[model samples]
Target: MFKKLFLLILLLGLFNHTSHAQKRIGIYSLSTISSKSGHLFGLDSDYNGLFRAIPAYCVDYFSNNADFITIDRKNFQLIENEREIQKSESFMDGYVVGQGKSEGVDLICQSVFDVDTYSLIIKILDVKAEKVLCSSDKKMDKNLFGIKDLKQQVTGMLLEISSKCFENEIPVVRVLETKGKKARKVLIAAGSNLRLRSGYKIEIYELVNEKIGNKTISRKNTISSGEILKVEDENFSVLEIYEGNEKLLELLNNNTPLFCKPTTN
Candidate 1:
């Protein structure tokens, strides 16, 4: 009997280690300026009240140029574009290996005033590999003049100029700590073993109360997403779940504590 118990504990520990290794997550935001809008420069009037924002290409070209615009020769001008600068440096390096242009994240952006829209693009090249990492479409928001006593067109132009200055938004990660009280719904899915419907409800309890404290909250799921709604309460040693409204009940899964209804709702 003693030997059997020892072996069981060892096997359980190994299974847990493997389970954590398979989780997948990779989401990121690329760009957020009006870099893609075609409408540049706006107008100011009394009756209908209006002004067009800067043209989209101008925004795109300007953003690529690092927000700098200088007069060119007698006829045209030069846009110190962000992507253009990157491209020129690559050609000069003689190390670019891509078939043609490099690739990077692609994204889009929009502003508040325009009913019409713009499309712009940016591609960043890695110095060592000389390959594009990502790209995006960006939009701008002209919200200041709409609300406060301020200049909307000037605000928009300033925004465009600012957009031209930055390469990309810095990436940040936020870690959330959770408890059962705040938990809206629970999903109990274990491959072919467990199944649940959208509106089904259940109670959640803490398996390891010491670590979780007492923050376990609950909600009623007025909606469901079929298979994903089922949670797998591995900690409970059984299959159970709780329901929540659609707006509140997003993808609920994992070892969510399931309580006997009378004890909870």
Candidate 2:
């Protein structure tokens, strides 16, 4: 009787733990062909069946994990119906966030397939923070039969994506040179390799020292701002002073150790 009672108690404990530990996740339909074509194509019955099949695979992958609770098609469809009733715009990010909130999900994951490199890109967003927690790309190559194996290919990829959760944001790039020496334009340390876009506003910060416990800590002082005028190559970008103020130009002339972060509005 004591052994049976102990077993019952253990079962109850496990049930309670699993009930409270789940992190609700919403997986959107996979989008294919990023670099080859700027246009985004969604899942359909006639084409790219593999992309449509990915969401279910994701659900199965996380089913055993006590920390995850993926929103299935039924719940996701309900959210879509409600969105239509509310006449809300269905922009991908906005839609995902709305669905996540409606379903009380903690995170939303988006899958994308790039045709050029045959790579899969996964992006996970923290629903409450309204920010991307992580993004990773994995190449899906064909097997010996010269055919892609969705399950085998994406299993390892999913493992990689899962491991990157809660990672730090992309590191800040630095300013390498000022264009034309004393000119308002500058050269920076990011380019196509980092997937940087042109016309992006950036914040320039200078390294400053602060004393703490007999140790000097480095801090950033916002010195100026600029916009990426051109993407030069894999290693460099061209920036021009966005503010065009003499003070900012003078700061550029001062030539202090500087770093830049992409400006967010």
The best candidate in terms of TM-score? 2
Which lDDT tens digits does candidate 1 get at residues 201-230?
333322233324657633332222211243
Best by lDDT: 2
Q: For each candidate, what TM-score against the reference?
A: 0.20, 0.48
Clashing pairs in 2: none
Model 2 spans with C-alpha error above 4 angstroms: 1-18, 45-47, 74-91, 143-146, 166-265
The residue-by-residue lDDT of candidate 2 on 1-265, one tens digit each, is 9999999999999999888877888776665554644544544323256566676667666664557886665224423233223222224556667667877888887776776687787778788987777776777667686436565445445544664684212223433444443346767765654445687666766668999998998676776677778989876788877553355556645654566656532
Q: Which ranges in model 1 have alpha carbons more than 4 Å from their true place?
A: 1-122, 144-250, 254-265
TM-score for predicted model 1 compared with the true structure:
0.20
Model 1 poorest ten-residue lDDT run: 168-177
> What local distance difference test score does each model get?
0.28, 0.62
